[model samples]
Target: MKVYLAAVATGLLLIAESANAISVNVQAGRHFTHTSAAIGDNSAGLSFNGNWARSDHNGQLGSLGTAFSLPVGPLTASIGGKALYLSPKDGKNGEALAAGVGLSWTVMPSLALYGEVYGAPPRLTSGIDSYAEAAGGLRFTVFKPLTVDAGYRVMNMRGKEGNRDNKLADGFYIGAGLNF
Candidate 1:
């Protein structure tokens, strides 16, 4: 994991900044895995999907950061981080910090293929481990301000004692978003 993070951090530092516009996303969904905090198992609220998206796993209460959508040769890149305040339904408080990089290819004007890689280490000690996830999916712009995202994600987390034999936990993600 250390090597993976070092590689990504180094790559981000080397990539040339380009002319890109900023967009923000705020959506709410079910909490799975380490996301128990912020948005409990059965809760609905705002989610972070903006500049600091990569860093913010679920929706830490107070999180702030910046990310970029850069245009590569034929695909776009997503890079950013977020630090959120964690508050669970069981009266637990902590923080989750994350960083990620993704790529998107627009095959058509309104349709695109996307993939992302996320690595986030929690700051609080509530039985969560440093995790990493990779996913791919399809995105379609339904309207001028509406978009849909459907994807499957595979992730791995350090088990009880940072052992590597534990089975990884991943899930499928399907939903829509609005651009304002």
Candidate 2:
């Protein structure tokens, strides 16, 4: 996967040296319980969410995204896509791809709210099963360089079709971002 990402990123950089509107980051957090979609008799599975050492733990998640802004008379809109990858302590990692589009009213010079969604095609990694989160969230920027965001994401996969065999993942997420 690293090789694939490196190749694609390298290609993008080579062909698109003008892509200055981009942000790449890494995030780790205690994904709230709701993000796990705990069904009956499966509460124990979610208990280990924050336990990075456990298979279900949500450890360091990396995200890469690019945005392009277009001006239309009085309104300005930005459309972009992002990829999120999370490597669990239990040795399972899932990669998701999101093609998102949003509009900003630019009510203030430093503040704007945008809605976006992320989705994954399908993949397998390691022995632990995992799938993508077809999720949506809102992002609000403050001070122009920092942003706070919250959203819900869900993905369903058939056994062996995902990394964790046949288990499903569905849940809500809250996160933030910083831009340079």
Taken over the whole model, the C-alpha lDDT of each candidate is 0.51, 0.42
lDDT of 2 at 134: 46
Indicate the residue-level lDDT of 149 in model 2: 59
Q: Which candidate's TM-score is highest?
A: 1
For 1-180, candidate 1 gives per-residue lDDT tens digits of: 999999998877655222222233332223333221121111011223422221223322334544566676557776766654434322344455768777788888899898877666645333444545577888788986677777775654443344332223356666665444
* Candidate 1 Cα misplacement greater than 4 A, ranges: 1-64, 86-93, 121-127, 154-169
TM-score of model 1 vs. true structure: 0.53
Q: TM-score for every candidate vs. truth?
A: 0.53, 0.41
Please provide, for model 2 over 109-179, each residue's C-alpha lDDT reduced to its tens digit, 9 standing for 90 to 100.
Answer: 55444443444444533233433434455556666556665655443322233333322334555655544
